[model samples]
Target: MTLSRRHLIAAAPLLGLTAPAVAQDAPLRFAVGPFQPTAGDTRRAYEPFFVHLAASLGRPYRLTVTADWAGIAVALATEQLDGAWMGPWGLGTR
Candidate 1:
């Protein structure tokens, strides 16, 4: 879904850390921050969690590793990310 900038901003809060409303078959866009030194490392570390979400949600997903801690929030705000694994600080982005 192509979200307008206005809609993206408006829905940021409502979306939380989960995906925007989408078809079950639509690939959910999951994001990871710079918790690890490298994007590959981060993706590897979070692989199992993504597997779990895939199994539980019964849907496909794509992962994005942000270059910095704040990139996750930026991705969310721009509607580039659908789901994310974040801590307290990410919550403040709203």
Candidate 2:
């Protein structure tokens, strides 16, 4: 099975809701897709964003940057990316 399906299946037990349904949880990893990291500057610049998000959500957050378009596609398709910025062709919806 694909990684996406596997992740969903593994998370099935935690998918149930309480009395009132609401998505108040935070994502563990924030994946930035298909972006070129300039001498590790991306990590330094965006690390604070992850830190702030984690602090606000009371959970740990990690920033993940995929190397190139293909990498991003693979990550997206495999569900390794929680949130990403994809270009027009990166989505592979053609």
Candidate 3:
């Protein structure tokens, strides 16, 4: 079945390490920092990667482009992001 953007958005809050009760079919929400020239550019660059990841895992994957490193961190910390591509500096101390 084709997953819609609404479905992915609905699943965002329950994605990633903190989501133990998430369904197996739930889409993985992958977050990326704003390191590229634009959000569209970042999405274009990583779309193939996410597609391959979904195919390999037999599950759907969604890409979320954050406005900045802080946004990425917030998404991760709040369990809204299942995975992330970010720099070490963005990973603040615990």
TM-score of each: 0.66, 0.49, 0.66
Of models 1 and 3, which has the larger TM-score?
Answer: 3
Candidate 2, residues 44-78, lDDT tens digits: the string is 76567557544544555567766666765676567
Supply the TM-score for candidate 3: 0.66
Please give the range of 10 consecutive residues that has the lowest summed lDDT in model 3.
14-23
List pairs with backbone clashes in candidate 2: none
What are the per-residue Cα lDDT tens digits for candidate 1 across 1-94?
Answer: 5445456445545545334344357776878777787888988998787676554555677887778767877887887777677855543222
In candidate 3, what are the lDDT values of residues 1-94, reduced to their tens digit? 6666555446435334333424478886787777679999988886786686556555777888778887777776787777786755432211
lDDT against the true structure, each candidate: 0.65, 0.49, 0.65
User: Cα RMSDs of all predictions?
Assistant: 8.9, 10.9, 8.5
Q: State residue 64's C-alpha deviation in candidate 3, in Å.
A: 0.7
> Where does candidate 3 clash, by residue pair?
none
| Selected candidate, larger lDDT, 2 vs 3 | 3
Model 1 misplaced stretches (Cα beyond 4 Å): 1-22, 88-94
- The better-scoring model by TM-score among 1 and 2 is 1
